[model samples]
Target chain A: MVDVVKFSGEKEKFNPNKILKTLKRAGASREQSRRILKDVESSLKDGITTKEILDRVFSGLRETPGIAAKYDLKRALMALGPGGYTFEKYFAEVLKHYGYEVKINQLIKGKRIMQEVDVVAKKDSTYMVECKYYNYPGNYASTKEAMYTYARFLDTNSRMHNFDFPWLATNTKCSWSAIEYSKGVGLKITSWKYPAKESLQRLVEAKKLYPVTVLKTASKFVKQRLLDSGIIMINTLMEMDISELRRKANLSESELKKAILEARQISV
Target chain B: MVDVVKFSGEKEKFNPNKILKTLKRAGASREQSRRILKDVESSLKDGITTKEILDRVFSGLRETPGIAAKYDLKRALMALGPGGYTFEKYFAEVLKHYGYEVKINQLIKGKRIMQEVDVVAKKDSTYMVECKYYNYPGNYASTKEAMYTYARFLDTNSRMHNFDFPWLATNTKCSWSAIEYSKGVGLKITSWKYPAKESLQRLVEAKKLYPVTVLKTASKFVKQRLLDSGIIMINTLMEMDISELRRKANLSESELKKAILEARQISV
Candidate 1:
């Protein structure tokens, strides 16, 4: 047993089970999860911050090719932020893969107000979604955001002849008040791991809509350039020829081939 | 101008114009409003509490038959609580007057949860309402209540094939966060003098569904008995024959007659 210090300055006995479980949730096999936990446990010392342990695990996973793809996913998702627009586009692609016709940044006129809907999806029913992207992991979508989205729905729905479903989708978990408010207003919500069966992770895994930020071989500058040119999804890059990718992403031939190979290898 | 102390213990110069505006909003004529203000101004003393001013206004209005009906309205609405169930029934009656088919204390099953709705009204559209009744005038319906109500709406609507409007109607004002949150969730809200044209006072005055507690002639005990018997609205009481009113409300013959006559006079 090792004493670990949390971000809040509290000390508690560290449990290796927590790390093992997290590794498994990220798609590691049982053997790989146990191996990762053993490595983390061997490096643990008294007063080590939880952040340091996570950094160690992340760096250690890079040496293991088989499990690195799964482990890099959470880190890649976190890196997509501080800029919410990229996440929204990425989210739109995920929804599109689920068979919904999606339009981003749409303006609709409601009875009493004009609303800017982040994404409008249509299948049998029209859905107006407010995409909340947080730069940091711990930040939550608040009740205030949920309330405002609902009001916009009311305004827009009053003017429409057809019924519209209001949804609040965030990159991170919503606050307790936000979740409660969303449920009360008939607003569907999808957060990172909330709603269990239909969370962002579930959708990502089901649709295989992995973002380019997850490719460990790509440099931050190359990733940013590709993201800027709207090449967000790994599938999108994989579909493109290496020459086209080099031209669009402003990458060297060698870097482009490596990125494309990494995207192809991990996505499968 | 007289200086008055607020409930929060802040002293400010009292303006008679503020009183006049409040009277007018409650449906008092200009002449009657000015007369009431003059009486309040003359009686005012330095460092008087805001509650004391309201008390003086209420007492002074009781003497004037022409203006009393309008001024007692705010007070009567405030008296509806300590018991929220009674208020829900009273609110149902008000909805009924607006041509809605109303049900009180209904159980509805949502996709994820079952909800006990305070009142449900159906007309062209269905409305699920949560009634918040506060016993005292100074108390406000809070953000926590709004959040919970929204969650219930979400759960219930998930199972429903038809569209339903979720509304929160309170006899008192809602807190700032509550109001903000209600808007976000698309939850319709009706509170005392809130949202200007769609407030509870506006709805009551439009339909003339004044509750029995609004009658200055009825004592607290008698009012409670009438409410307990489900004789909530003035219109409902006015429709009842004197003998039935006495039997159902357990009021003395004279008290019944006086109450019935007051209901009849004020309703017109």
Candidate 2:
């Protein structure tokens, strides 16, 4: 056992089984999981940060883009931001996956003025989701954001008589006051680490509804091309014919083959 | 007569009387105002912007920094920003002048968190104001800001219970949605041009409650020194004897004399 430091600077006894669990969960065989865990444990140093340990896993599994890319859920979201996943589109698809009828950039007439809603989702009741995407992490969706979204919900619902509630969804954490005020006002909020049961990270992991860019085998250019071709979700890419995929995304045979293999590993 | 284009791009025939009104208001004699206006009209080209005409006035009256500085209220506010008139303090004084017993940066314990209310004021009812100051203009206080302020107002009001209502005071114009939402939520908002009768600009001009930095004769260095010494208002300078003011602000005899002259012009 080795003592390791966490990102929050807390020291913890390093658990080798944690690595094995992660590997196996990402589709590695039992033997392969043990082999990777052994490799990671051998190089692990006492007092190394958890982040460094995770980086070792990433390096150990670099050849396996599907598993490696999934290691950092937060980074994967940030990658989705700049690497052309179009956070709004990805969010809309996530809503769709969860059995919600979703529409993006809906223009609704309000009592005071016209309003543009980021994502309109409906299940038993209609929800107006305001997506706040920060390309970089460390930004908090503050009380201001929650209240603004709620106010818009009030304004829109008053005129259209459509939305039943307001949901503020951001790819970051929420300030304490934001959470408190949001709950107080009946506004639903989901972020990287709120609503413990179903945060943005949890939603993606629960369904493996990762964006195609999450496949590290897909270069920025290929990811953008795929996104441009309307193959946003990994499952969407999984359904494409290899020849059609190559032609549509302008991918070479090798690139297409590697992307498909990685997609399979994650999709499985 | 030359047509002058306004800041909003509207064309209007140049009216010498506007300049005359501004000069007379700022303490320039009518004869001096006409002398300056004659010079401005001679050089005035067809389709000159109102801003350029104002610049001409600034140049014409540059020797009289006190009166010249007061010519453009908006620009003077902007000057107070980078030139070092602490906006929160200035806002507090403005509130004080309006008969609100004001405190800057009042810390109140809220149900959620420790709230730092900017410019807490008490008149008939206690008003919690949040000051939004953009060093440069063109930034509008959006609906998000209004909503955020209101939420804080609600949270702070809950525990402290000392405050009766919320007020949003910004140095710039507000978005249409922001105004509508703020009013609908029962939040009092005063910005550059909200509340037609009692806007921020109107309040500042209603009384000659100009910040000391509005004295164009005071260099940025001089203005900063004066502010550091707690001489924020022009009236404060008026009340101080020459010897006491010099000792307090470390001003050279010439600098002190010029500042006092300009203060007298504006104050009288």
Candidate 3:
């Protein structure tokens, strides 16, 4: 057994089962998951840092053709970042692909005051989505965010013609109390791996609308450029030819080809 | 001479001097301003509502060829409404016209947390301008606003590279204490006719960047449409051809002509 240096600098016995579980959760095949776990175990030294272990696992997964494309989806989502605006934009694009007419950063006129809505989506009825992006995965959308969304909904309900649905979308999960309060107020919630069917993961998988940040092959600069151009979803890049994509995104030949391949494989 | 009802419902003596003062402030020639005031005095009736008096004056100003287009610059500015966002946008445009690169609703990362700056402007140095737009001209920006702006400045100064100037820009006057506190903290302030030379009115007149809402002839819908399309300044409307303005704003022929005439007059 190898000793793993935790983020806090504390050493702990490395658990191969944890890597296997993470690989399985990422939709890796049973055989491939076990093989990657073996690779990670072999690479781990007596006092390997947790980050090094993760790097080894990511590299080992990339070597596998079937699950390599989806290896960083969870990490990439986390990378969408310290600011909530980008997450809101990416989620708006996802909802748009799911057939909702979405407007992001909308200044909605409430009865008493003005509200800046993250994303106002319209289909059968209007849905106001509040996106909460957390840089750290451990952080959860709390009751404060839910309560604020509820207050905004109450203020804007009269202005909306159709039935107003207040929804909270977050890259991370919500606190138990937040979920309870949201349910009490009839506020819909979509967080990572929550709500089973309507979670963010499920929604993205159902529509194959992955954010550009989720591309493992793309660098931070490339992701930012794509986001700035309103190309948040991987499917948007897939719709364009390789030459056009390269030219528009200012990507090198190798970067473009790798991005397209990863996007196509993961989306499929 | 006729009687005019005040906002408090008191029957007040009709004063043509008041009208003359307003016209002169709006940059009307002395002779034309007196004539317009005389016309307003003739139109005033016994126990006339303040609204009726304003309507008559606006109508009378519209008849003048030279300054008719610039009539109601002050009133229209006040009409930018019950909300502060429009005022912020208008002031930002005014600053932009003054050669300052302006950004509205910018999230500035502070030392402790994030601060939402109403207007971040840069020329020789960075100026963070907090706009306090009160619908009722009587409502002055109080000490609370000044203190909050000063607090934000302290938090943002270390983050800015250049000399940071904290400014408070309001559509109305600041309270006495607010002025005193601002002076103590070296915070620059611009209010309606307060600073005399550097006031909001002065800035608007210097650049001739009046907001579209100042047009007494334009309907609420037309003004809102113009605002939504990022056409805040009166000069922006003047730059467009009448045909394009009518098509884009979806204005009636009369409304289009009146708006264009007023925009062209005021900008010149």
Candidate 4:
């Protein structure tokens, strides 16, 4: 059993490096620390946000007894400012992974702006997009303004350079009024839901776009099978006529019972 | 000169616990880290959030630069999640320093049901506020929905509780239609602006709230004279009357000239 009193750091002892270093000094191998740090750095390079890093660190620490003190970790993390930028950046990277050309720290018109626009795929001359990770339950007045500004900017800049369509994406369902407003103002709005289990299975069908390695192995089969069964169930329910099956089986009521017994006997 | 290259501790070689132990080793005295840790524990006698601990660590680190980069501080910090109770808790504390009571992880209703209100502050019985920190141009619609939800929440909650006023707050300024829409829905919207230098000077006048402290020593007459002059300047500005000085001096143009000449002669 871990010594709670000996292992517990102070309330503010959640410093990641400090905790890692302390563990190393207490007989944990330097190589192990290096391994964790490499994972962290790779996560960062893969565009994991600072907040996610904190989460991952805490998660890893929780796995080892006496490795993480409840209070100390929080204290160490509180030292950093609320890491909004890190979260936003990582969310953008996730979108970009799906064949989207991501633009960070972009400006529309003369106003400077930073928003995670998911996919900026060129559909013919127009940029078709699916926006994800949008803050849910907010008014689109500013989004409209951003669209108007972007549209105006695109019209001038793109025409001069001869570029085409610009698309807008959103995570939460768009507002009817906002959609109408965008239409009235000649701005295009597109929707893209998160990759749910069902969708993930569908996406995996075209495995070239997203390798199976990207998903967890154990749970992956479960979701895929569920999706497969759902489709089969729906198709049979909708298109397969029971009367046709009966006709194909060529069985009357008494004959059906005899046939079922024979079929069971054959299997036995 | 600051050695930027010397600061590079390859992430592949990072050990978080080593960093903690190093701070214990390099702090002002052998007991300094212990004392700070004790202070953190005492401060967190009540339940303390992860962010509060981080803030303390950063504060302690800021005061001691020798051990700053020794920890590979940045990488360790990335372990936290992006936005959740942790980030909201930190954001609330910062806002609280400026006199706000904020809530985190709550749903709001406006045109529709919206979840995830970052920060909500109450100024008075009548004022309800929502705070948002977005690095990029946010989807205004969602924010508007958040603000609307906040408004609606307050509208219902305030009426039920019989609160007098309600208002919404945001870091990003609301668009014209959002503001108008809010008005239509009877929601008062407000934006918080950080105090300017001039505002701080004005704050000095509220000396009862912020008392001046003496650092070393100054002559009594000099102190009295400085205070009197400051008061005079304030009064004069308040009344917007420089002419009052002429009356107080009781000097005509000729008399003032004669006095200046007499002073000059005495000096000579």
Q: List the DockQ of the predictions in order.
A: 0.03, 0.34, 0.01, 0.01
Per-residue lDDT of B1-268 in model 1, one digit per residue for the tens? Answer: 6689975477899988778877775556787677777878888888888888888777766655434665667678878776788888888888887888988888776554355788888998888888989876567787656765765576567545243778888988887867776776677888887878978888988777788887778789999899888898888887888788888988899887777777766766
What does candidate 3's lDDT look like per residue over A1-268, in tens digits?
7788876577899888877876775678898877778887777789898788778777777755335545556667877766777788888888877789998898866654455789999988888887888876456787657655765565556636343788989888787866776665578899987898888887877776677777766788888777776677788888887777777777787887777787877766
TM-score for all models, in order of appearance: 0.50, 0.79, 0.47, 0.24
Best of the two (2, 4) by lDDT: 2
lDDT of 2 by residue, A158-220 (tens): 644589899999888888988887877788898987888898878988999888877776688
Candidate 3: segments with Cα more than 4 A from true spot: A1-18, A25-27, A41-52, A160-163, B1-268
State in Å the error of residue A165, model 2.
2.8
By lDDT, the best candidate is: 2
Question: How accurate is chain B of model 2, given as a TM-score from 0 to 1?
Answer: 0.82
Cα lDDT of model 4 by residue, A155-233, tens digit: 2233323324444443334445444445433445543222333232222222222211112111334323322332111
Note the Cα lDDT for every prediction shown: 0.76, 0.79, 0.74, 0.36
Instruction: Give the per-residue lDDT of model 1 (tens digit) for A1-268.
Output: 6799875477889988778877776667788777777888878898888888888787767755435655556567767866678887888899999998999988776553355678888888888888888765456787656765675566567646244788888877787766766676688889887778999888986766788888777789888888988899888988988778877877798887887887766666
- Which has the higher DockQ value, candidate number 1 or candidate number 3? 1
Q: Which regions of candidate 4 deviate over 4 angstroms?
A: A1-118, A124-201, A212-268, B1-108, B114-128, B132-268
Error of 2 at A56 (Å): 6.6
| DockQ computed for model 1 against the true two-chain complex using alpha carbons | 0.03
TM-score of the candidate numbered 1? 0.50
